[model samples]
Target: MDPAIEAIRTFNRFFTRHVGAIDARFLDTEANLPEARLLFEIARQEPVQANLLQAALGLDRGYLSRMIARFEDRGWIMRDRFEADARTRPIRMTEAGREAFDKIDQRQRAAVAHDLNRLDAVAQDDLVQALTKARLLLDPDAPAEFIIRSARIGEVSQVAARQSILYAASHGWGRELETLEAETTAAFLRRFKPGREECWVADLSGTMAGAVFLTDEGDSLARLRLLHVEPFARRRGIGGALVDECVRFARDRQYDRIILWTHTVLDAARRIYAHHGFECIATEVHHEFGEPVQGETWQLRLTA
Candidate 1:
């Protein structure tokens, strides 16, 4: 077997045992791991559909039906039909279910805290960050809320350097990308317009997850520049939100159109722009980033 596979299996085995994931009664609760997990899923997102729950957990329909029956019998959850669609029944946690979930949640928290308390503060922080990164790596849409806000002068100015470093590790890009980003951002700062131009940053837990800038082009045209999301922050709609925000700002400012220049390598960003009604107007071979590549020009007509 490959060494990497063996190492991953070894870590999985150790972590599963450490977390008591295979325990017959997880965390000393009456519910087994599966039952406890189902309860947690329901508690976090109550009024969830049964089909969604089954698909989310990859449980068989029969098994999920039985589980729902068990929950209903225990008065933990109640199933009710939709007003507009009697064929659809939504599952909601009852008062008893809330109590049960709270117990399990509290117990799990205490157990984890006990283990974390053994480590020093730095070690604990490192472990937490590692776990967060692992989850993001495994599931890009892991439901992280990045706070989107107007970029302050200091924060907006730093995006060029931050973006340069952020993409360098993944794309193996060099000073060329940095220089391009610096020039555009520098120009944006120099030609600042109070309400006509703006930059927004998507902040995740005090870190800049992504950023985009809107700049006036003197012809009733607003151009989106420096649109990027960190790799760890992708698949969470951050890029799409940034684009939507920019387009909305352009429409509000009465711009005739919003245009952006992006590379063909950026499939995700292109999809986002297209989704927001940006039509590809042009493409050309360019060495802007020190590499011969197809660059794209996408524009959205705001009059519509």
Candidate 2:
């Protein structure tokens, strides 16, 4: 075996052991890593449908069922069958299980953060950048040329809905569904007024995975919003492409500057915007959803 691969495997084993996630604690059963992983996955939401987990994790149906059943028996999880679809079942965390999972998760995040914090800030940034570059390089296995075009009325709703779900889950904003629906409807409506706003979508192998919008704010400025890349399509140049398109559009449209707003917790998006020449213009402490988040505004100058 390659030395690097061997070293990585060794480090994974050592790390898991030290974190009490390997031998004597979390993964010590017929359930194994899959069940433990499922517990962590369902911990984020009120309930997770079986199909969602199966698709998200790309797990075998039988394997998922068996692991879920084990957790069910242990009283760590409960599965409820859907009346609309007899074959569909959803699993939710019990109060006891959620408490236990949160405890473990906090420990894990603390451990990871502690080690990262040991490095200087520059070194930490470099590490993340390197990792991101590596993933980007390794991720473009899908050889098909993705189709880039404007989002249609028919598909805009679903895209908006998915984007809302992602944001809501990340921010714990229960009302995001209503807020995002209105925003999506508005953005879609703006598409008809081509001079005011432009929304672009990327379709990869018949699936839409990336989207972005540019809205004219005034004579000198444009607003970049609704930038989203689906999880499965990340690291494949979709996001970078969308950003590049935005920059070019702003320049061509004679906008002097482009401004974007986002939360600080979205580190990857921040990095992407930064790499594309966006500078932090303003930041404010704001509470949204259930979390106290720092909202940042970034600006990019467009020169002729």
Candidate 3:
């Protein structure tokens, strides 16, 4: 079997076991996991149409009909015909159903808390971030929120390592790039200034999705360094957002010009720079990162 397919199957199996999906009872509730999920969905989307529920749950028509009948018989749900359309009916939870759902919700929360409490604070945070990334990967069109904020403690090293890994994977760069990133990151922290220099990290749902650093280069010039977006978080405007924040910060700091060095292979980043009115100032063939590449310097006049 293909490695990717096998990996997915393994994850599915593990998740099912972790959630006690094979158990006769879920969260010690009277209903199994699927039935509990249906109840929760109904509570969440009260007055939801039967067709919408079926589509959302991807349930078989006969199975859903039987489930609805069972709920109605148990006095757990009530269905009402649409006033405008006699053929359509919406399903909603009864008082008893809501009470049952509350129990299930509490149990679910407790179960999750029990699992998370086993790990330390950092490990819990890591698990949440990993799950968020996995969810985003599985649903590309899902809505996402990103925030640009100053880097926190220990984040500089994290950003540097991420940059090294990304460059190596995307451009086949060697350890030279990693060394350069680490040195530059260290310098930024060592000579950090409150107002003149800044490092911004793009956070997406609790994970560090991207980062950029703006540092004083003397002569009223600011240099943008180590701009990178994680591969999983690409195509979400994160790179552009990081660049825009850098430009905004530089302009706010009263810099006359903002500059950055990049390569021809980084077309996306180049486009972002151009979009922000940066112009190519110089280009030269350089042997770095174990390869010969055209290194280009770009600058934007902040005064204009």
The candidate that achieves the highest lDDT relative to the unseen native structure: 3
lDDT of 3 by residue, 45-121 (tens): 98887778888899997888887787888789987854565226888899988988899899999999999989999
Candidate 1, 113-181: lDDT as tens digits: 999989997688668757766677687776776778999657676789878887677666778989988
Q: Between candidates 2 and 3, name the one with more favorable TM-score.
A: 3
> Could you give me the TM-score of model 1 versus the true structure?
0.57
RMSD values for the candidates in order, in angstroms, are 6.9, 19.3, 2.1
Residues 30-132 of candidate 2: C-alpha lDDT, one tens digit per residue:
3344556777788865477888888878999898887777677778887675557623656788876776676767766787798798999768866764554
Candidate 2: where are CA atoms >4 Å away? 1-142, 177-181, 187-192
TM-score winner among the candidates? 3
Per-residue error at 70 for model 2, in Å? Answer: 45
Q: How does each model score on TM-score?
A: 0.57, 0.51, 0.92
Q: How close is candidate 2 to the true structure, as a TM-score?
A: 0.51
Ranked by lDDT from best down, the candidates are 3, 1, 2
The clash numbers for all candidates, in the given order, read: 0, 0, 0
Stretches of candidate 3 off by over 4 Å are 1-8, 83-87
